[model samples]
Target: MTMTFAKRSGLSVLALAVALTGTASTASAERNLFDILFGNRANRQRVAEPPRQQPATTPAPRVAAPKISAPSFHDYRPEAPVKVDFAAIAAALDEEDREGGAAPSPFLEALAGLAGFDLRAEKEVAAALVTHYERNPGFIWVEGAGLNDKADAVLRVLNDASAFGLLEGDYAVNVPLAASAVLDTPEERRQALIRFEMALSARALRYARDAHLGRVDPNKLSGYHDFPKKPLEAAAVLEVLARTKKPAAYLQSLHPQNTLYAALRRELKALRASAEKEIVVDTETFVRPGSSHPEFPKILQIIERDADAAFRAEHGEVLVAHAGSETYAQELVPVVKAAQDLHDLNPDGIIGRRTVGALAGESKQARIDKVLLALERLRWHPSHLGNRRVMINAASFTATYLEDDREKLSMRAVVGKPSNQTSFFHDEIEYVEFNPYWGVPRSILVNEQLPRLRRDPGYLDRAGYEVTDSRGRRVSSASVDWNRYGANIPFSVRQPPGPANALGELKIMFPNKHSIYMHDTPAKELFSRDTRAYSHGCVRLQDPRAMAAAVLGTSVDEIGREIGKGRNARRDAPQKIPVYVGYFTAWPEAGEVTYHADTYGRDDNLKKALAKVEEIRVPGS
Candidate 1:
């Protein structure tokens, strides 16, 4: 409890007490007040009274109370000059505590036992629980020997964890038996209450952390994954659990608040509610409009199941005609085209790989995996991706510029191949360089160029690459001993700014440790493909001038004019724009969920990692 002091007669009672009575007790009261408002002042006490150090050291492990501001007395007034007796107020507080009595509290005892509770999560979680109960020891779930309404609410939320792409068992707990049923002894009742209290706290805290910061540490999943940890204060979770009347709503609110996550949730719900059995179509080659296939009946059945009722009725004759036909007749083209359009395909009625993938629509289990993986990965990034951002979705092979959560511009982008996979991270765009020099990375230098250099020492020179020695001196490529280096090279190789340069005209630089950024590529033909994964690691933009203009806060003409006068020139962006190089197999686009092929097999990797993490979170379950 805190006491607020108001000023009287141009000085506070504390100050007046100090002035009137120069006793240590009065000074101690003032010091205690300061400590309560700010933090512990043990250092001041140690300096004032060295003999009291022994007693002060005993309370060292107790967590400090949160600092609160002192109440202001700006409008305070008194009808008449009144005297405030600080001692009387202090005595009254003490009397109130004495009246309440220091009876043994079973709840407090149970909370104390949490120090030894085996919370099977991270060490930080246990530490957080300690800090939480140390600050304010109280029960948020159980009441007496039985569960309360708040406990019921939390249990309901935990049971529905599957809807949020989480396992219910992770936060599951057996409800304590009713007082009339099994608690035949006082000790048993107390033990039941203790288990109920500690288990609720552990599960609630775990759910809070998993819903907010995600369950799996992305860094542990794979070498390609990189994400900074988001802090989850356990004390704050306890505060919410103790205060909020609507525990169910609060638990639901822990999910990622974004359009993509919401869409995925809807997709998950729809998929699970769907009663249609999955149909597996087997095909060896492209099934064109007029080409015959053994599985044409299965394909038509899939279209009929997914298409609208009106379409099904209209195409009922054709469907019956091709119910078991092995030939793909011309009459069934419209039906196949309609299904293709619905699945976001080119509507060419050509059952190519993408069309086949769409027709099959991934097994129900596979779709669920994609949605669950997407939800977990979405939690790795910020909920609000700022008003201005360039998001590159590697799975979709596209980059979109968004402002105020609305797509401002979108363009095709070529990402890294599976062997040289692009990383998943976010950074700010700092500058854009025109006629940029391509300083070859060490991976390309050693793994690619070194062998070529070993065979033809003058290869780099013929390719118009400038070579430098270890001391940054310009050297001929033929002068270096390429055989000496195996995995790494001390010398650097770079290409001067030219039309034939790999990085093309301009490169948007974020300058991260991965050396990945959005750049213009001379290989424009790669962007025309359905799946554009060809770069070593950097994102290659199809329209570099438009991206430059967007980041620089200029027009395409202005960007072109700057590029025309470019002699390896660089221009800083007016302001930093955030860029997210992300990978999502299932994502929201144009108010609908669009599922893409798991390009780097990240979905499988993440799914395996999630299973492994769950095994650790709940050993047997």
Candidate 2:
């Protein structure tokens, strides 16, 4: 039978060959096994035996092929072939790596990644990054291969966009290519670098000017640069610039003869001189007892102290404390007792924490700041202040009649509650009414009396309010639903002209959008309180009849006669008085700063806004 050959498994043959290779003739045996596994069956039958080979007489000298070198991982160099000091290069690499650059230029790293690229292309991108850094030294460094790719990509975009020039429209090309250039001569390159740096500086300055940052007067800039700087002066200069059409011309005119920009220079010099003068005066002056500089004694202080004490006695502890000694309590006691005489409080020597807090807790500096703010507000007031005036201090709860800036008479007043604060404004007293019938304001009718009327239908009748129909016939208060009546009440409720009426004895009218007027309230107990917030927005005088009599230049009886006749007394008075409702936390009284509570809490709001403005730090600062 003919011997047939079959294909052998490569794994099985390799294993047999490995086992056979340990014996002599192992190479020949392995070759035979490989031929048997690969040769066709018909061919295997006819296969010829190997020819007798000549045995080697001597072993040839073993020769080894040249060792192939693995690619060097540490031999990376930039395409530009720039000479870099290893230490400096390493430090820069470390910094760049720390900042994110692990591959090439920081700008390229910022670009993140790019697939298609060449060495020369990367070098060009590196150059642009160097230029950008030179232009904007303030720019923060980014790191990593990703960042490098990003920066290079962005640089390419910029270069393409700015092919014609460095700057285009509002944008500018900034790439620092020269930083990594390998020049033939180091000295010449160094000189060129210095020139380039100088050009960059000049460009930066020009950019600042174009941006209007350098529009400020040079003198003002110098003033800001100087020691003990008055920073607010710079703001004032800016304000002046805003108000004027030509800021440069305005600055130039401040020094026509090329005098060192006189406005800022002169102002700064004056401020310094004033400061020196103040220091000298401060050393020389000896403030007298009860003088304004150190302290001032007033009757109001005593009243405040006693009032505080009374409050402390009633409640467990005093609300506020005096700044100085306990002696302020003693000093305040008598004065408070005197005010108590007017306010109907019992005279007492003990001035509690509340009273002392009210009197002495406020500092002089706080008062000055308030006055300054008020002065700023006053700048927007109208220029034509009337010759004859009535000034009402809403804080003090008092009004003064002034003729030619001289006080004619002063009277007590009851102002609005802290929540319903009296508005700060001026108005002309056009008319006055004696024995005026009360025409209730809509707000008062809706908010106050309506609720009471809803609960007790007899509220109006008990309060002497007479409800009348269109035909002037009296109507029963029970017929109305006070809650719904605000919308449906067609008839007017008029309080008859009597001393017990809501408007008291008189009413003074001034036309304003707020519907605010001066009148007298039947609630006499309100005026005796120190802090009064009793009125429904309008001002209530302690003695309205006296005020009306003074304004009309007539006797009280004649005013009563006019009202009794019910003639719409349209008599033209000889003079029209100006009335001002003002807010003043601090004012000069006996040459001292007299501080009052910020009853409306306006000071706190203004203070917070001012603090926020101060926190901002601009470039120069």
Candidate 3:
């Protein structure tokens, strides 16, 4: 009853079917063919049809995996045994080992053993071995051994070489046996050692250069390597290493107490002090003749006239005239004499140019320079200053006793002549001599005493001097012919130990190269003057007995007890006291400032030397 479409063929079947299909399609379109057929076929049996089913699902297609490429063996070849000149290499290696080779490596060690060098368990040899292999990589191919084994052996040799200091340089590797033997003379050994050391140092430096990829300046290396001796050569190498590897550490390693640092530190302190604002002079005025009154008519007229006048008529910053009364004159005479004594001028009561210059503050800069020089000198002071101390200010002509920064006492003193200046340094107060003898210095004996002795052979005898033989036995002064004994006197003259001796009452001994010390002088009148330079170079104290007591920490009676024992009584005072003989021309005093003449002219020379030194530049950029 249902219509169905069939597959069409290519030509003829298509034409026949086309005609029949058209007719059948038209008839079926108008009629209910299924109903008609069903009615007619009711009597006939109904044809049965089976139910339809769906087709089965298929899985997706599989993809093939990617392939990996193999490693290339294009240049592969079996490693050949390294062709080592075992004999020559061994000898060279042994020599280097003996001298101390470079950083050790296994190849170097093996090479060393081949040379019969038994450097057992030396770490330097091991380091040398590693270093050798690193530098000479071709040593890796020794046929029968593993790479590490060969390396170990090579390292052993290199380390051994290093232990011998051979790794430092070629000179180490080629040291002659004879050179190692101790020479009869130090000079010979020193020279030989220096030569060998320089060679080793040069090699080490060259290696460093290569490692750093640095420009090897032969001249610079030579300069560094050219040391005075082996120790110096070693030091130079260490210095280079320090500079390159650890600059700060190197600097720290150096002694900070060097002279240069000390000088710099002193200069800094002085500069700091100079920046302070403080008036140098206070309560200073000039006395005029006939002036018990506050002002003199003539001096007041001069100052007032100047104060009134402008440019050209300026005058009277401070009154400057003459001494007023006989009392004033007497006082002024001593002050003037003091000034004269200090400056080596005539001790007349006349205020001349030199004295005027000193009082006018014209020498301030010169005085400051002296203080600076003193500060510089202190840089070389001994490591410690004792708890109790004595400081002699030679320029100011004063001695101050200090116990732990507190002033115990002070005394007027007479210092050296302007020409024979007192030396600056610290010494210990070892002993005190009561009734000390005066053994005159050679300079005084030759220049001053000899002339007097020539004038009269009995001059010394009259002066209470005793001639003595070399053995200290007293001899008669009459035995010597004064005319012939001008400079040829073979004997010595000494003042006997007593209160009347030039070293009066007591002498404080702080032995030094100058053979100078502080002692009581019968010349106490000298200190009353403003300037005292009566001694040749020794310091003469006004109240030396008091000074001795303070220094010894004992009463006067106790000191007497010690002195009575005589025989150069040695007392280790309760404490060791430092006695410093220093020179400072200008220093702060109370509210004002005091200055001293540059009695010795050392300031000028020292200033010039300082200037020259400041201009010098150290080496090594």
Candidate 4:
């Protein structure tokens, strides 16, 4: 991550890039600086390279170039012979190894052996690389005419690592390779170039593994997740790169494939634009119904960073401040919501903590951190979510049914309350329960209903709740001494299926230990509120009929007709649809984005976790 911008005294771009491999960053690609080294306008005095962004999805086929072999110099030695010190090189690598970093001394030793150890074990190894050609007069992988193109492609991928939430620092060999122009001695330079080339190969493999498999395991933390990434083999990765025509694009394709990840990347581009615009506001601070604040101009300026921003597209007026008050006095709730929508917030006109946190309306650094955290969470998802599936964002309190990456239906969703949060997990909807019974969870009884039972046993009786023993035998609530039992209520309760039942008319079932499911809610009014965390962990669907129709492969009328029968019934879904219950605070839908509340505070949890592990270390992923 090029976040460390401190000049390296005598060192230039190459050394700076080399120093960054140990850190993380949110830095953007630098085109102007890159141009001086490898752009089309680069000096042809050195090997010319073209740094261009390539489509990362499917790489175009490459036209193979003729190989250029290095000439042998074994027959006659030079007048001024260069001393090769294998021992000194080994000692230098060992010194770095003891210090504890990314120094793979064993591998470095093997690599040094191939180079004949014409190496300088000095602190200024990057600067010393310029003298590599003066020591030796041959080359390996760095001799072909196609070298410049391959080198340029790798450099472009390194600069654009932010697009995939990976750090540029992880793949920073570009600078050294590009600055190879300064190395005049062909022999030593060829040997040194191979070192950088090998380093790139090592870094690329690590980057690809991280991009494909993700860094952290969600299940390792306190969440419902079963990681599905397969182990990566170095030989397999090398084979792919060997055949890859456009190496940069091929490597780039190894990120989250869903559209949401791409959309977040698009939004990140906007963050860099409004970095200087800070607009901190209270949770209650919002665009007044009748008047707009002077800060309204500032808001417009920040929101206008994206020329095609939804707010700007909807309102193309040149908003200006008044002469005296220096404020724009007009309705701006729509604008606020538009901006919030673009950043994956709840899209409420209210400028709450979640909204401010997303808009970078606080500190620029905070905004950067928030965006970076979002990208990390994206990495924790299934590599390929089913082509046809149901996705419910617990944070957004919304559910979407999609087939072939296109949405068929979407509706407001009521997730769990703060105390009883909906977990992050995924499963297939194998069956549906119509007119379902509400077998209340024990936690709910201990924390919520037990107090009522303690106060008055008549409460359970009046609520029409049926109590039973652990053996499934029906029992009366009045039989137990409320004082005897603490928070552990060793009884089961079920509300009969009907209008008053919490299951409403339907409940979609999936296999999970959390006992969470999707179902219709009698309290439909909860979905209208800006904050919809009103359930006891299970998701309460706003329009269950539509969801049922989509999942069961039928029409809404057919689903309603079945539900209208009044009697209890169960049916298996013809084709089981996978359901993903994810927690994305910032998500992209269509060309815009939606920001939702961090209802469970999971975002904060993830941010802290990312802060600790600077890179990937998922257990057995």
Candidate 5:
């Protein structure tokens, strides 16, 4: 019986070793293995004799025939061995091992589907969402075709978005149960989950961004507004939400933590709670303290209403005595003065439009509007405006220096007029210039000075302005052709340091692109006015020496001494002090929210802008 051979396991082992080792050529190794197992054609004649003993051996020796040559291993030389990639081979094996190619993760597919939605316009948000889940490929808000506790927590925080001055409707989202009621199939249920998941993430991101950076983009309000719109990363938001046990707390943490913001929120709550009807005083005529007017009784009533409880207790008799009188009585003067003081006015007891606006106090809705506006404006600025800084509120016509968040100095200020609105922005106070030369701004030169210079070419010369050509060389203002320039003049104009200088004795310089600074003004009487928007654009501090001292971290006497030298000199502040030039119609002052006239109508503009934003956010609204 004959047993035919088949390819054994050893053949596969030999082939694997040959591929792995790569030590010799493939052809020679295979041939040698075959020759070793089964005799080659050339060596077939050589046969082994069994036990015939010496007779058999003698018979084979007698047949010494043709010479035969065997294959030699020493003569074989392998060419360069091919390099093998173990990792690639292992990966190929892994692929072959997997039954069907890995199925796409349904969760990841839902995340990628965000690109097809409205998020396409919100590029930052889309990118962040995709990146977040790719890093953490798991469902956060959903669990097994329904919403999880985390989603419930997020919705709770979003429902109370108004507490942070954000509109609840902007972050409004419906629960997946609504979708579940409409769909019965498993695929539709999954589709509902995807929709629910994306919507939640989008709303959470919007809330996170709006809470910290404000709903209204300050830049879009008007050219006068300047602020860097802070970006909120969606990935960062999702990462925090996924990791935190208290999702509501994490969501609420997005609001600004500044004291002013906190105070505004409290004021908003109070205004919403109050039932007092707003008093409307429509008279354009000014009511002097002692002068009688037809509307005096009405003005008195409004003043009494706006005054604090303490004022009412202390001067209850005075208010009661003039309660029905038409004349602006001496008894009623204190009441008007107290109301003016409460609202941060001149407190001169002259009931003009500004005084009336203050005394009448805003309608509940109006005050709430201002508070909400103030809160939004606060969000535009840094949360922590360093320990030592200066805050200039243009609407209130005041400048304050705070050290360690405590008021160090507060004084009256004159800001830009309506035509030349002081910008709403922030910068660092770098230095103070004593007896500073005022470079006539191009705007002033083109609009005001050029027109004068055209009528009389020697106006600047008469006005004591120093004119120079494009170079630094001083040139006669009369020599230049006034008609040759429109807005772009080759000549530069500036006022030298003198008593008649526009900037009085000293100017605190932050050196911004707006060319605005806190400076002393020759026009001291402007600060006495009820509304002090008089400068070209810079802030005119009533007490420049005191402000200088505060920013320089020195004494007022030292600041006075520097100016007394009567020379043009600049003194750098001890450290850079933050100076925020802002336009806040409602601000916290002396532990109370003081309302100011919206001189530039920024509040109205902001109101309109927000309305448009809401309309876009909620299409039918």
Candidate 6:
């Protein structure tokens, strides 16, 4: 019995390798297993492989090749968005062409079946027809044999998703569309039309969502942040695409729905293009305002690349030399100050860890990874952001109040230190407490108060921290064997409202499982630094009263009057303002993009996750 062989698995294996590594090339005039395993993708050429020699005696028992799974849409696509209303889609399809050319009936009939359907492509096709008609009274996008002008337009956008780090092939645009574009039968044409529209719809929506929200999950990065996964507003995007004459321009608008995202994206692209040599961070040598380093010229070049009119006006074109050597320009004072404030630095116009990191800059790849991760974070938020909300950027260590998209108040905040970094989550600021007591977290009691208690038997008493058993009875720290408990102190610790209380005078409540809240701190001086990750896990607001005024919808004087009463009380807000504790390493505020040191190293962790995810997804030799 003769057994014939199928094509070698080597070619497909090579293809799979290319897809995974995203590089294709030709081998250097040689054939090897490494070349086969790793696609010879150096000069965008594939090396021809030699046939495998048969075994000396028994022809390796005619084995059928192992089945390699073909790539599919589900392989790379994000979570299917929550269902949306295609209610108006049929109406758009029923729409008449005031223009002499009638809308394609086959396409229209295909669309009627899609009413209340979740197929994004049908809606896209319908919207395009309506938009084209609305713009030109007698125009039709899908005409005779194959895809017309609009189909080409849709495919173009679908093809470009790769520029935004998305895979166009995953959309399967090339295969089905090409097959349909050449078919003669009307039935085949109809099927092709539907498939084409659907592919573009899925592709466009995927691109928009990935661009605006991001491709990865923030919670996956650090389990601390509870970022809600919001569905992409794909219908709205389809509408926008249909309405715009410049389809490419409309697609470009799909990135970073917010300012920080746009800023980060631009920086990422620019950094990747930047050719500045990496600087070795000299932790020992501090670059004071007047001090100069051998790398100053290169640093100045980088600054000049992004300096705007305000930055330039504030800093002269040249830095006057000082001490018979190079001096830090006085002009860059505002530059450093702005950078420090935006990055949660001391804002003292000095080069510290935060400042030095910014000055030294990151590897281009590193910044690109950061920007990509930041983009992913944008997707983790709800589909809607209230016109007025509180933004507590845990990364920047600042709380900002926005009314009608305008920044009203921005104050320094002390987030959880590196050991116990702040959690990134969102909730409503429903109420505020004046002269609030500090309900110390168990982690704090275990890691902090317990150690201090061991050192000083009366430390809790001196600090005014009250102890209570889990059963609600008062407990004396002196009675417990501190050595036995160590870090796991079983008792509760509370600091009563007073001048010495850790919670200071007020607390902002947004309840979560973590039992973390924002409150005032007696250590107000800590906010003076650019880096203020001081607390265990809770956030410390630099100015709670100011935040109170913003949240309560009251004047600062009114808050002052309420506090003057000396009554410890909680007040409910007329409307619960939304609060977001987001971690962003590179934030865009004011005018320029300000880079921050990743205090939690969340960026690095996220990069690792991305690689791990890819590895799990792609099969290997």
The TM-score leader among the candidates is: 5
Cα deviation at 480, candidate 4, in Å, is 2.8
lDDT tens per residue, model 5, 171-280: 87756684545778766666667667766876787788788788776876666777876767777887888888888888777787677788899998888787866666
Give per-model CA RMSD.
28.4, 43.2, 53.7, 27.5, 39.2, 25.3
lDDT of 2 by residue, 1-621 (tens): 112211233344444655545434656556545554564332333323222224246634432222222111121121221211223323444465668645554332322211111111122223433344433322121222112232343333333322211122212223334444443454434333332332222222222221221212222211111112112232233334334544434332322121111222333333334422110112122222233332323323333344655554642122234333223444344444554454333345333332333434434344446654443233223334466777777766777766664556777788777656666667778887666777776556655666677677555654556677668766656555444444445666766666566676667887676667888787988776656667756789887767777788888777777767753335545666777676556532222334466676655644553343223212111
Tens-digit per-residue lDDT, 455-562, candidate 1: 777666646677786788777676665655666467888887766779998999998988999999888888757678988889999999999999888899998898
Question: Candidate 4's residue-wise lDDT over 137-211, tens digit each?
Answer: 223124341255665676677778876666666455533443456565544454555565544555566567667
For all predicted structures, in order, the TM-scores are 0.76, 0.45, 0.47, 0.64, 0.77, 0.63
Evaluated at residue 230, the lDDT of candidate 4 is: 54
What stretches of model 2 exceed 4 Å from their correct place? Answer: 1-354, 357-361, 468-474, 483-491, 555-572, 588-593, 609-621
Off by over 4 Å in 5: 1-121, 131-136, 178-185, 277-280, 283-295, 304-318, 329-344, 347-349, 619-621
Native-vs-model 2 lDDT?
0.45
> Which is the better candidate, 1 or 4, if ranked by lDDT?
1
User: Compared with the true structure, what per-residue lDDT tens digits does model 6 show for residues 105-188?
Assistant: 565545543443444332333454345433333212345545566656766776765445454553445334444346666656
lDDT for each of the candidates? 0.73, 0.45, 0.48, 0.62, 0.73, 0.61
**How many residue pairs clash in each candidate at the backbone level?**
0, 38, 50, 14, 0, 15
lDDT string, candidate 3, 436-487, tens digits = 7788766667667766665555555544566776686665554445444434
Model 1 per-residue lDDT at 310: 87
TM-score order, best first, reads: 5, 1, 4, 6, 3, 2
Question: CA shift at 485, candidate 5, in angstroms?
Answer: 2.4
